[model samples]
Target chain A: MAWTNILTDLLKVNYPIIQAPMLGVSTPEMAAAVSNEGGLGSLPVGGLSPDATKQLIRTTKSLTNKPFAVNLFAHNIPSYSEDDLEPMRKLLLQLAAKRGYDLNAADLSNFKLYNYLDQIDILIEEKIPVVSFTFGCLDPDSIEALKRNACTLIGTATCVEEALYLQQQDIDIIAVQGIEAGGHRGTFIEDMPLPQIGLFSLLPQIKKAVRIPCVAAGGINSARTMKAAVELGADGVQIGTAFIGTEESQAIPSYKTRLNNAKDTDTALTKAFSGRWARGIRNEMMNEIEQAGIPIPPYPLQNSLTAQFRKLAQQNNDIEYTTLWAGQSAVRTTLTQSKDIIRNLIEGYEAL
Target chain B: MAWTNILTDLLKVNYPIIQAPMLGVSTPEMAAAVSNEGGLGSLPVGGLSPDATKQLIRTTKSLTNKPFAVNLFAHNIPSYSEDDLEPMRKLLLQLAAKRGYDLNAADLSNFKLYNYLDQIDILIEEKIPVVSFTFGCLDPDSIEALKRNACTLIGTATCVEEALYLQQQDIDIIAVQGIEAGGHRGTFIEDMPLPQIGLFSLLPQIKKAVRIPCVAAGGINSARTMKAAVELGADGVQIGTAFIGTEESQAIPSYKTRLNNAKDTDTALTKAFSGRWARGIRNEMMNEIEQAGIPIPPYPLQNSLTAQFRKLAQQNNDIEYTTLWAGQSAVRTTLTQSKDIIRNLIEGYEAL
Candidate 1:
């Protein structure tokens, strides 16, 4: 039972841990460092163009020969109208003005996000060893094509129903993301009630219901949490927030600092930042936006609107306006090299 | 590494499982059945008279010399005014009329709940082997007196903050009650953000922060769940739903059937039931009461008022009027003798 589960054996990693494919935060260097340290590293190709996806895949391959995963967002594109986008835009403009930026409402219009079909083409063509999808599952045709290419597929499930549905589609692994996880929720339904179960409670329920390996994700930033995940029947553990401050992680300095300064009780779930529920550390902007009761548009529209505001705020050290994505355990992580973090995880597992 | 943890050693039980002290559901016979089968069973003394609490303790002891636990509520009794009572009385009267009873608003006027100080006297005098409390921690005097009596004190905590607070009070065990738990939430601060972390997430956080044994509770009703609890750093498990159908359990026939017919998605948290949020199956009363958006009074008043209504409804075999407390895993539990359920748990843990 010493790291002899299907996940480790299939991924060819020494420890049953995965560097969670964090969209804006993970870099090729970071993924390489984790893979070099005997844990599976991941690069997110979720929202990139096919060419960009291929270029990053090549960059990562050159950096490390060890196994790594490529992640994609397979969510159905949400439709919205002008009426839906007004309040969120109004709030965003006001926040930008307070930050001393002459931001306009039109800059956020024409939100665009296509599904991962083209990205899948690049991954299959490049013979990518592992592929993970969040937000929703792939259709039967895509599932067949990936299987033919010898890709080990991973799907994200926030509830038992989603896990079982993913299992029915015959995926390789299920990343059981609890409600406390950072960034976007991997929920499939647009209006489904948030399955507010925590990581530990959710992991076992999914593990018991499905036969596939479960990669427990969400607030897993420490050795104790990792150990608890393993003991609770996780074949592997996926970590995100803990790697925010590493040399290779792509988060801004202030974002890293905010995460570093956080405490156990600091994080909360808000659709305010991206119009999709995700956990993050609370700040002035979040408080103002949430308190205003501004109805946000769907994912890509509200996300696109806030994207520019977040970037400009980060550039000026104006954390009050940034969407600081972080898990509940964001405060407990140490600032270090990604390799050292992986080494510590192995040490912690052995110590347990 | 085995069942050699503080909770098992202190309780002198063979298995690391404790049938939850469910008021109105657990009987002296149920407690004896569990203790006799080598797990600690608990009797809840919440709002009970000192004499009645003593009588149940004696009855439990008569059935089995094996170790058992006595539980009490440690909540601060809220002060209410006539303004608060008027709205709740209106709702109760309307509900009673629908159940074919001529209920008056004054029936719920005299809301009363005696504190745990008197119950502690009986527990100490009788030398109850184990004692647990919920809603809040015991004060200095009660803790000191309980320690003097050498009682193994267990405190319920829904969040790490509460667990740390309980740790400072020098409790013997921390029952990590997750948000998915049935009945009342044992939160101390009414305004504190509900630490919605599941048992797995909360257990490790508590285990990492404290030195005492942690007993995982909530939605743990099956062998798989019990095993999962043990693997995730739980020294013991406090189960409620699974034991509801046991021969020794005191639940009514229709209530037991409702539990049997429940699904994983059947439960919802409603303050309408007891004025404190607790998860249970949605029914005719729950649907009607919830839809009305009735502003409930504080704990003892609303709880006391509902008690009479539930009693009358049960006598008439009316399922719509009774309060049925059940966890998320209610559907998975089956009707059986309590001893057999205990045996299954032991077998499940060993198999793991």
Candidate 2:
């Protein structure tokens, strides 16, 4: 397989590597560093306001003239009230106290979601070339507006069904997030029961089912795995955990150290941190929350409530308190430069 | 990677394919068929007595003079009385009656576990060429005894930790069973918390961590998957569900049909069927048992108790009443000959 495939041509990158759209961790500098290196770089403005998102786009644009992608959250609003969140809040407080950490009670009075419509408007206003959707599919009107401009629309899918659904909506690219991927599962039908399929099984099946370009995302943090993905039928490879270990990534020094120190057995999926099931390094806070077995609040809300605790943990360099988002192949993570990471992937695969 | 690797050289096989030892379904005919096709075939005499094991060896030998592997269960005996099993037995009976099936009460008095020591004696006396183990690791003396008799020893592992353990015990080969694999997990440390890494990530890491030949076994029934495994650094491949749908597979007609009809989400892990987590098509009996939240007896015992219901379900061709043990890739199963499956794997990988 050649490197100059549809994904590389469309993205105008020298290599078929896309920096994963990791919210909070993947900053403008990291995105630019990869984009400058001739690989598709991504900035996740999913958790930010429209104004903040526009500012991020400008920062990334200033850093590098090369093409870059910006991602937004399209998850459905899950139902929950004060009562539903009460038990989880109390349990978290108890855990924090037990661990000798200073934690404040959650204030849900200002718990409004990010306006994705406004986000779409900002992207169009900023003339962002590449836009991606995660958590769920974008509404048809949002897709149309993005398409009305010359934006390449990428949708995240966890299974073949989701890929088919994306094709029906005329998605330009499908980012296949295998079960081995770190962070949140990008399942559109949140409540529907579905099996977790790996990228190797998912890529070939999705390629057979859909005509669009597929970018495999999950446990693909190395050159060997990158080559395996392309050989197994992936158009390109999207990497996350590998970048987290890079010096250019905004991940805290301790966070980077913990990720590098992690064994293959250190991670598992848990819904305690964000209500939606996500793979992360098992920590005291998450483990305690899982043990409590309290009814969790929905996504975004659950994520907001724990933001303060995570921030505190980061400030104290306590990896045992915050969620360590890494993939099943976290052991493959190496601390180096972002551009060096991209160079290694291209060189490794090409050498093979 | 050539087929002339350590695995093929050690096992004296043409292709790097090993038909997984499936008890109750893998017959002498199936084993012979696979071996005759230039791949290593395996017979699971895990649940049988010493006399029965020898008889099966003779039958397989008579069918083909080619090399084949015989497998056994090495699980520790869990303490459980008849009273401990009452809840599951009653729950299954109620489920059976509700489903309008004629089911027999389990006779628990004849529940003497297969004396593995005696079975080992029979394998040595009968001059069995190859013996494999699952469920748990064998002791040092047992490994030494098998080695003393000039018998090749293969150990099953679900993770890198287990693979390292197998290497320490002087095992000949490590059958790395990924999480996507069907049948019971070959976890050695049942009490330890372990991550379920898929074969795509598992194979490459295990190959780096251990010098012994690693056989990739999990959800690898396709040419694409087989090629993916080899490309990912597996010395050989062990497949189970792909062979189950064949005419020679002793799986019932409906079981074969159900396997063919399985979708990506059709199967999941359930301790309900055998009181040990195994992936299978979820049925009424299994569902009811899972919902009952009852403590059940351990393996070999729980497996014995549910034998009558599974038999009755098979007799009636009622898929909802029986356990359909297949991998996540069961949807790819084809109703061909055993030799045809091996041919497809080699030809598919070779064609690539």
Candidate 3:
């Protein structure tokens, strides 16, 4: 049978690859460039305001008018009391001091990161063709609304149990996230274990358990792996680290430099950047945090508290402090234009 | 060129696939079955006495006269002062007491492991065809001696830097082990940060860095993955956990049951078993060990201390108290005859 899905046919353009919706790093220009190259480009609105999300989507549309996916965080918001924040703030200050930074509680008190409820509305209003949710499934009402808007809804799952749950929720597609996926794990229902499942084992089991169209993610940076994913029963592949260095990405030059120099063995998951665990280049800050033996508060608060440190770290070009999100294949990532990357990927896939 | 080598041609194996020599679990019958089915079978002699090694090799020869390898530990013997043992013994007594066992300092003394020097002589006398070493390289003198004995020497490397070091030692083959490999890491020279590089990333880079033959290990257990490894430029593949359930192996019935029922998400690495890290089914012993926070001595010594507990745990059929070494593909393993396991592997390779 010929590959018939929208994603499969679309993949025919510049390889059956999709640039993952990497929040904070993916740019409108980057999305457009990938889409222009005939690959599915993704823009993550998880960290953006609704109005900002709409404006960004409009900007991307003006640039290419190509189909792209917008991603959201569907994880339930965990609660944190004021009492929890004070101790967490103290912990962060102590951690920074260990790294030779003088920071007091004032530096963290005004931190702000409200969830993007408006971004999901804009995706429906803008009639985006695809919407993907990570961490957990969205409320059934929101999923139904997005489906009514003609958006293909994709749910992210870290295990077969989660995928089956998503299937029962009636989502159109499932992103089978192997443990190697960079950034925060999409483990909503369950607290994922450390160094969770590898991709090879995770893919076939999830495929056997669920009937929905599957897209494999995590550490898939090469054309050979992309083809292998399809052969192993994935309809398409979603890649994040591969696009971190594309010319159109908003990632800083320093970030690109770190990625370029990364060895295949360089990446690891650390909770230092945000309180939630995410994979990144091991850095001085992570080493200090690991040794600190202090408990971090819940997600957004911890994400917000460390936000200034990360920004300052990025601006100073001090790689030791930055959150360099990447997979095990970081060393293979090339610094080039997105169009060239897509072209090479297409060539690699066809050669296979 | 068609795949042709001593390992490939001798077994009439189209591809070089060798089941790793797991000392405690890998049996002579297991190695023989793999050899009979056209793949290299290996017996890990790290934990066996020289005489035991001879008997194992003899048993294997009786079953299948095909080519096989013997694996050894090449690390220096762990040293501890007389004072060190008293503190270590006292700590263990407290742990045993918590587990409802009464133990004294006298209970901690007698532990002996097979001497590698003695085993090497036995293998040399028997004219074994292949020998592999982990944790470090065999001495240059030993490598030269083995070569004179017509034995192919394989060295394990955990990093590209280590791989380069091995190439200089003039070994005939190199097994590139990533962090995902089960059992003690093969890092011989220096303790490097865990690379966490999956087979996809490690295989190609090692292929580029070293001119010697390369065998890919760690988390590779599927037919599709085996094909991918060859395509990734590996000359051979070494698998361990995937063969755990075969009838000829020495894994306990309960351990095999746990492995067969394991999920892709089940296995995890913790230094609780031996001072060295290993991946296996997480059990009560692991949870208690992590919580107790008792410092473990460096390996071989720590490995020696745990032997009594491990033995008792296994004899009592209490899986919770034992160390069950398995890789991520434990879920896909089956309780079949060893010969059938090798037969299915050959069929899988041929089908691919």
Query: Highest TM-score among the candidates is held by which one?
Result: 2
Judge candidate 1 at residue A294 and give its lDDT.
65
| Preferred candidate (TM-score higher): 1 or 3 | 3
Report lDDT per candidate: 0.80, 0.82, 0.75
Ranking by lDDT: 2, 1, 3
lDDT of 2 by residue, B249-280 (tens): 77888888778877666677877767677888
Model 1 Cα lDDT, one tens digit per residue, B180-270: 6877778875565666665655666777788888989886866667655665677888988888877887778888888888755567777
True contacts kept of 1: 0.18
Report the lDDT tens digits of candidate 2 across residue range A92-187. Answer: 777777777788674433566774776898899888888988888889999999899988999998877888999999899999888788998888
List each candidate's DockQ score.
Answer: 0.35, 0.57, 0.45
- Misplaced by over 4 Å in model 1 are A12-15, A190-192, A219-231, B12-14, B99-102, B219-232, B316-321, B330-335
Clashing residue pairs found in predicted model 3: B135-B188
lDDT, model 3, position A166 = 94
Name the runs in model 3 displaced over 4 angstroms: A1-6, A9-15, A87-107, A332-335, B1-15, B86-107, B332-335
- For each of the candidates, give the backbone clash count: 0, 0, 1
The superposed Cα distance between candidate 1 and the true structure at residue A185, in angstroms, equals: 2.2
Please name the candidate that would achieve the greatest lDDT relative to the true structure: 2
Estimate, for each residue in A1-352, the C-alpha lDDT of model 1 and write its tens digit: 2677788887878888899888878999999999998899999977677878889999999999998999998866676677777878888888788778877776878655656986777888888888899989998889899999898999999878889999999888999987668888898854545667666457777888999989999867666667667766788889988898888988888888888877566677888877778887778877887899767676766677888888787778776788778876665556579999898878876786
- Show model 2 residue runs off by greater than 4 Å: A106-109, A332-334, B106-109, B333-335
Candidate 3 per-residue C-alpha lDDT over A1-352 given as tens digits, one digit per residue, 9 for 90 to 100: 0235655553333444678998878889888888887788888888667777889899999988778888888755577777877766776677667666656677787665656465667788788988888867888888888888878878888777888999999888889887678888877765556436666667777888888778889867777777657655677888888888877777788888888888766777877777777888888877776777777766767777777677666677777876888876665454478778777777777777
